[model samples]
Target: MKRSLDGFPKIEVNTQRKEGKALKKEFFRKERDLLGEEAIPENAYWGVHSKRARDNFPFSKKVPPSLVKAYFAVKWACARANLEVGLLEAKIGNAILKACEEGMEGKFNEEVIVPIFQGGAGTSLNMNINEIIANRALEILGYSKGNYQKINPFDHVNLSQSTNDTFMTAVKVATLWQLDELEKEIINLQETLQQKEKEFASVLKVGRTELQDAVPITLGMEFGAFAEAIARDRWRLWKSRERIKEVNLGGTAVGTGLNAHPEYIARAIVHLNEITGLPLAKAMNLFENTQNLDVFSEVSGLLRSLAVNLRKIANDLRLLSMGPRAGISEISLPALQEGSSIMPGKVNPVMCEYIEGIAIDVMGKDQAIAFSCSSGQLELNHLGPFIAAHILEMIEELKLGINAFTEKCLRGIRANQERCNELLEKSFALATCIVPYLGHERTSELVQECLREGKNFRDFLIEQKIFSEEELKNILNPLEISRPGIPGFGKVEVKRP
Candidate 1:
């Protein structure tokens, strides 16, 4: 019954109880380098290094759950490799493997207490994982949780592995897993856009450049471009898999595979691939793979491109759905919530705005990742934890944003046919339909005349006797002008006298 500043009890293991009293939980002393022996809770599935990390780096409550699962997978693969090469005994290896499998299933997650950002190139996180798995494996073997003499975290659980290789490999594996979800979300967004494209296929609207009406285009075609951009993002997400698939799992400390069996080094990645069910391959040049983190930077660039595309689409949506009374009002977005506290019925493009914010965050993370990747020196890049944190954040945010946009906005959009036709009728750029026959100079003269007189282009064409009503109707067909492939619209048989 004790309390700490964080409002949680300073937990102590129960070690003794007098006769007729229930026994208190027991604790054991664990010792390490530079730091002396300390009492670790007997029930807690982590060792002294983990406790040290919890005290040293109080940045966050914990790392991502995906990362924990990925580390479990890595440790299990290492155990398998160690057992195969006869470096670790079968009984201890089997127990460690069981603990790892359970860890992947989300067991022992409470033991992963270290913050993601720490010194030592993720050594603290790696040791924390090693400790958790080792303690849990010892418990499985009917020994105390902190009994390192019988089942040591470093000697048995972390055999044939180093923090540099294992942690980086785990980061890539976890990133790929998260990217799988991101890919699905991107595909969903693209499909929604394509559906909207088909729905608005025949809706004619004026296309603008520099905020000035330049020509005519269908609303469908505009949405089709959005879909195409998302499709490219989807492709980029898939392509990133190849770049990250090359991992350095066996290249311990400095990628020289020192203190690890040659057989263990050769087979460790094979076991990792089997465990993760990912197409992971060991790097041919372990040193380069361990030293250079450019692959993550490349993936970050792809993610940044996705954010840019998302921002463009969201901005267009905001513009298109500006106002019901005075703005473009070309399309109406679904009203999910009241936009203003004072104004009644003022619904905003909140979903698009939310997506825009997420895009900006993703782009920012990409820049941070690029800088972190370049900051690495010599045998290791200590910036991996930072890179992993940002990449995962970007993926999760984009996934959620895309899903919200698809469900709340894209699916519920309704085109204003009247407004679309109204704008097209008002746009003089439609005069370009007859430019081939009338020549640019003649078309320009007519356009200027219509603008100067404040007359609609259609009426001016009819008044000038350039063509009869039927001919003008056929020439200025909105759909034909937007797509511009009709047979006779542009074919001038004779010049107007």
Candidate 2:
């Protein structure tokens, strides 16, 4: 083995490969398992199980980076418990602990390569980590990478754990942290929208029902509604964490705890919670915990609700800021980039479109998670890898989309006050303000008569002396009509002769 100043064999790989050329590696180390023996790269940290998985499931999908980090946290905690319970030898246990601590910090994420969706109910993925840690533990103890004789991947690193319990525990831990990140971003978006609500508090615009003008509304009200919907989503999402708090890590394969020591089982979860600082609990009904994945469905439902609100709000923004000339240009989003190639000076609401795209994609991921959750077998939910992949992807995409929507689009939006006033000027919905002065039946009849005559309702109000010009202007003031109570009810009394 090649030696470095650290006294352990130098761990380095040659990666300069041309299109048709092979990776120029200088040495190889042989390692074997139940399947067979194989020559692994001398300096590479991964071992035979990882190599076999690489060849078998030839997909670009690696375990989600977050899940890798979380998986190693599970390993680290289990190893600690095993050491305390006299299962792991002292020196080797310390080496394994150091390796796992590094893994938890994401030092060896590149080694956790496997298809995000794979067979063996995630055993291949679990072994990949075990192999990496075992090799690294060997290297740490002044031995070569493939010298599993010094510290074995299965017998030492995975001492009291099974793929079923460990993988799902990692998924839950990773999801808890992912939820924390996403919740912070949601809070950012909610606060920003609230600020915009205050900024546009009095900018009046036409309120639409089914895309038809129905009443007067302030632009602030629109933003307020968006903020409120996100607030509800934030609460629901925060509450949804309760569903995944219970983890079944101590229950080995099939929830039987068949190979795990009772002392290891009791203390492992405690160490795990200490390492992760999450509200983790061992499953009371181990079988249910192993086989039931409906918690994913519940959380996905909450995520879908948020996606729906995001889609609706973003689409509304797209429509509200549609055009600077011909469309409903009542507001202007930040002009991010050139919207068209052939057309000159055409700026579209691409940010809103981007957010809408993310929302739609997240909705689809939620559906995929639903199906994956339902694919569980009798003793264990074999689809955790698939479910976890989509959940992590959805969370990352949502965080990115929400952050973009907040800074690039939502914060930079400006209410076109003049355009808002112009829209209400030609409107008939302003006639609703007169309903408090005139009874509903009389106002409805008069509105129908004006529509039939193709005459302006405000002009007719003045011509018929139902109201003076000043009185009509005051009664139909966009700002006044948009506020609570009847516009000009007490102030402008009808001058009836």
Candidate 3:
């Protein structure tokens, strides 16, 4: 095992080139000239990344999977887009597509070592993908790795594109893809709640006291509210998708389209859309697209909205399933893991707690993305790297949060019918249902008498002989009286028994 001068494990260099290969000699000369005595190894294209960035910002672990996916997605989209526009040859486009297929099939693992965080606003990530794809294509063609003569990273893999356009475009494409999955899950959760609502629509309980009766409501109404909130969020996400569709492809190198054929830009967009089946369009104004990252900010805001609703729903679940003995206990959540080491049968809302924490992280990432977008200056966005990192992080975190909330929290939640009935029977909140029939004055007097004399409102009315038992039962039918789906109402239909 070779070791660095500082005593750490040194990276080994492997090359397919034979001794005295012309390209290999040229690479060594360039390496020595670029890096001097402490030269970057001839085999390592990502030397700048490892030697500089790895030790400086050691906070994040290996590059996140989502960010990796985004990098590949951008490369794939750019290749196809360039091919369609005729800027890149069909063979190059085909090679990029092949590389993408291999990547999707898990070809590149940890072996292709490149740090996710680097300087130059994602230039390292761009080069990493280019090098990987070029090398992979070379293998397919029976050529040596890093042999640009056969498959050049700049001339072939990154043909007619720049980090500015490719990186930003890839971010948009990847985010849109994640949002598509998110929308589906959100819809599924909403439908689940709606189904629960329809199932629990009939059962009712007494209001004000066990002795006094009050208006009624079905259990489904409560769950339906949750469904509606999720649906609204889904709509917001759908609207945000449009913002991502307008990609910054073809805006090569500072959005000038300089040194790029007009046909190349148009063809790339067409090819990208054809390959991905995503509604991607060539940016109308390349300069603005490259310089402005407002679209990412818009997408982040929508994601924040989603995270906010997720937190709200999780909090509600925790409260609704608080206690089987002391809290609301109106619902029961499916217990997954043991909650305590010593306490027997203790099951905490662990899934909800996890989801809440994930949402908080997403919220924090949203702020970071917002700041990155604002940091962009003239001619080119300087914060593309951070924006991509933050948004990708947000996507993965939200995906996990949604899945856990659905499977662990929503799927496992059960209405505590017995507890709901017990609470409804003891609540005075149903008094508003009676004011229409008895007049406000009489209703107030009856409520005060019941409270002051420690008597049930229904019993007090019956004892005073103000209404017969049959009429009282008809008026205070808890099931029928609470039937008003809309909140803040006075009259409840008296169900004749």
TM-score of each: 0.92, 0.92, 0.82
Backbone clashes in candidate 3 total 10
State the lDDT at 141 in candidate 3. 61
What are the per-residue Cα lDDT tens digits for candidate 2 across 221-268?
899999999999999999988878888888888788989999999999
lDDT of each: 0.85, 0.85, 0.69
lDDT of 3 by residue, 1-497 (tens): 45433333333445557667533332321211144423344344333433444545555445555455656666676667666666666766687678866764556745335555556877766766777787677666655454556677778888877888887787777777777777778888888888877776654543222434445555566677778888998898898877689877877888888767777777767766765568988778888888899888888888888888878878877876888699877788888998999999899999889988988888898898888899887787777877877887787778777876787778767778898777764565445656666667777777787788886555666688766667655654545555554332333343222
Show model 3 residue runs off by greater than 4 Å: 1-33, 36-57, 64-67, 73-97, 109-112, 205-217, 468-497
lDDT score at residue 110, model 3, on the 0-100 scale: 53
Q: Which parts of model 2 are misplaced by more than 4 Å? A: 1-25, 448-456, 468-484, 494-497
